[model samples]
Target: MWWFWTLWAVVALTHCSAMDRNKDKALKLMKQTPLIDGHNDLPWQIRKQFNNQLSKVDLNTIQTTHTNIPKIKEGHLAAQFWSAYVPCDTQHKDAVRQTLDQIDIIHRMCDAYPESFMFATSSQDIMEAFIQNKTASLIGVEGGHSIDSSLGILRIMYRLGVRYLTLTHSCNTPWVDNWKVDTGTEAPVHNGLSPFGKQVIKEMNRLGMLIDLAHVSEKVMNQVLDLSKAPVIFSHSSAYSLCQHKRNVPDAVLKRVRDKAGIVMVNFYNDYVTCSQTANLSQVADHFDHIKKVAGHTVIGFGSDYDGVRRVPKGLEDVSKFPDLVAELLRRGWNDTEVRGALGENLLRVLKDVERVRDSLTKDQPDDVPIPYEQVENACRTNYGYFPLDNTGHSASQSPLVLALATLLCWFFGGSSYSCRP
Candidate 1:
């Protein structure tokens, strides 16, 4: 009986030691660095609840949202892009108006609490916000479709302080085939970009806007990267090699992004990070490890699709749980510099490069009238042959043997292959 008591005491003491270690590690990580999330829909959430109806909830004490002044303070979220997510659909009569409304949400938040939040267009602004103990609120348009296929509208958005524009969302625009829809069955419509799309890239480059390729097809991503004068940003995406999700960036693409001096912000959606259909924290870490192995430290950052993704990694449920991620990285042997880069510096570098490109373009002006829509479409028609997996030289070829080998390897290793079921 006495021996049994001794064994129980030893087990209890071991458990307490383990808990204490985890706590200490978490505290150390929080003090070492400030976490910067690349994407969140705090503005979208605000718009969804109070779309021009400010009476519904007080902006000062927004009680019922994942991200707010109080929650950001609690989470230690030093900076984040308050995404201006406009859903892709032709049904909206005024796409630009809708986009403007989303932008207004951020403006309202900044106006309500100048001390706690500040709108940041450049890296310097972000740093200043940090110095002031304010969360730097940056803006990014979720879909290119918000511009209504007009370069004028794109310029207007840029002038309105929109920094990044996701080239495509779930739906492919008239100028690009979406990866979700482009299954290599029918002939590619826009291939990667119509001539109009090229103009869009040029305009974005000219405006210093970071051409976001997140949600675009692989072919589109390649074309945008080829055309953009500045480094690009994958605002919200993960490693496809780990989970095989269509939304995640593959190794080959990641390599090109690195070569282009671009940054691929790691996503936190469970489906993208892990093979699991549900949120799983451990599997999410695997994605970070895989991306680090392939892309190196320079190319990694966070792009948590908060409010955009229904399910998230278990430990990273909301903005408040960001500290948990910092702790996880520390456990994985990441030092302060590496953690800080992953959190925000890497993304800031891309933003600065975009600004430089914009500045260069502003210095060069053309006298020729803007190309007509018909001529743009005609130019794009010729490029449709650039479609992937099509007879076009750009298409990737698949081999049956490779598929067979992959199946065999999966069975041999774990008897299950990574799939994005949810």
Candidate 2:
């Protein structure tokens, strides 16, 4: 009996020690790989809090905000895609201007803290920032409204270092219907995506801009996946099968993304993750489980939505709590490689793919020609006329995907002298 009791006590102690070691190992791995968060709304948070005035907020020290330089360091965040989110209420032209302002502020923030931050546009830039002990800052424009239906504006945005663009916000764009605003409403104006909307995807691919599907309808998500030659991303969304939130990705879409070789960066908003008024870090991990089950580990990444949402998962209330989530994942039997993929490697791969697609299209003429207003209106009037997946009913000659591919072929044969550059 004494021997049995002693053996049981030894087993309990060993398990406890193993947990502590795992937690420590998780932190060490984060330091080595450095998390590349897919989205953070600190830029918009600064806009609302300090009126885009960095002087009012001291990021070097901890403030009332969810993110700060110190907290971000503690969390071992190596790179962040800061969201330049304009509200859905902002009118079209104002939304575009405000988005530019939001992006400018992000640049200013990086400049203001040179030692702590560096603006990064490519995966190599992110690695360089990490090696130099600075946080790699990338900008993401959060809504299609920011381009105001102008492809030229989109080009300028990418040139200005905007690496990704969310196709919609909380409201429908003229070319796309948002998930939140279109759900349960009258049939969406565009069943899935308008003719011009498909052009948006093509242009993004040509420009190397990541097409983020965080707020668009499921139909739009599917259409983009079918049309995109490069990888796509969900900058900040969760699994809808788990939360039932319209903002979350459905399982079917997750599988399609896996087929496209894209990634879905999980959101940390409690409501989106758990579909509950109350939530915790475990709830966040449950979302990871569902996404991984549907899409596999290579398609998973983190998009905390920090500073964008009011309530966060309990143990992940702030940027500093990122390591806590990593520790929890490690404890749940995730190995180092899987955890690293979720932290940053998956997103890096997506970025590299986008870059490769852009390089492939460099010889093609730029898609600067805007859709004429009559054509735009005609497409909108014929919204539900054709299935987005099988648009053979529409003239094959008018198909954007066909035109885009044709242009690529022409470029390959040295047939294009016209440059549609911005």
Name the candidate that leads on TM-score: 2
Question: Which 10-residue window in model 2 sums to the lowest lDDT?
Answer: 378-387
Residue by residue across 1-422, what tens digits does model 1's lDDT show? 99999999999999777656754675555444445677898777777777755557765577666666677777777788889887775212355777898888777778877888888888888888877778888889988778767677777787788888998777767676666754454355687788778878887888788888888888888998899899998988989898787788989999889888898877888778775668666676677777788978778887888877778877777777776666677677877677777777788788888888877777765322343444334211222223345354432433445445545664555445431110
User: Which candidate gets the maximum lDDT versus the true structure?
Assistant: 2
Candidate 1 clashing pairs, residues 3+ apart or interchain: 389-395
Where is model 1 more than 4 Å wrong at Cα? 1-34, 59-64, 90-92, 182-187, 366-422
lDDT of each: 0.74, 0.86
Query: lDDT (0-100) at residue 299 of candidate 2?
Result: 92
Residue 223 CA displacement from its true place in model 2, Å: 0.2
lDDT of 2 by residue, 1-422 (tens): 99999999999999989778877988899888869898898888888888998887889874867899999888899999999998876633367778898999999999899999999999999999989989999999999988877898999999999999999988778788888654686358788788889989999999999999999988899899999999999999999999999999999999999999899989999889878778899889988888888889999999999999988878898888888888888888888899999988999999999999999999987786665555434211222332343455654335667556655754555445322111
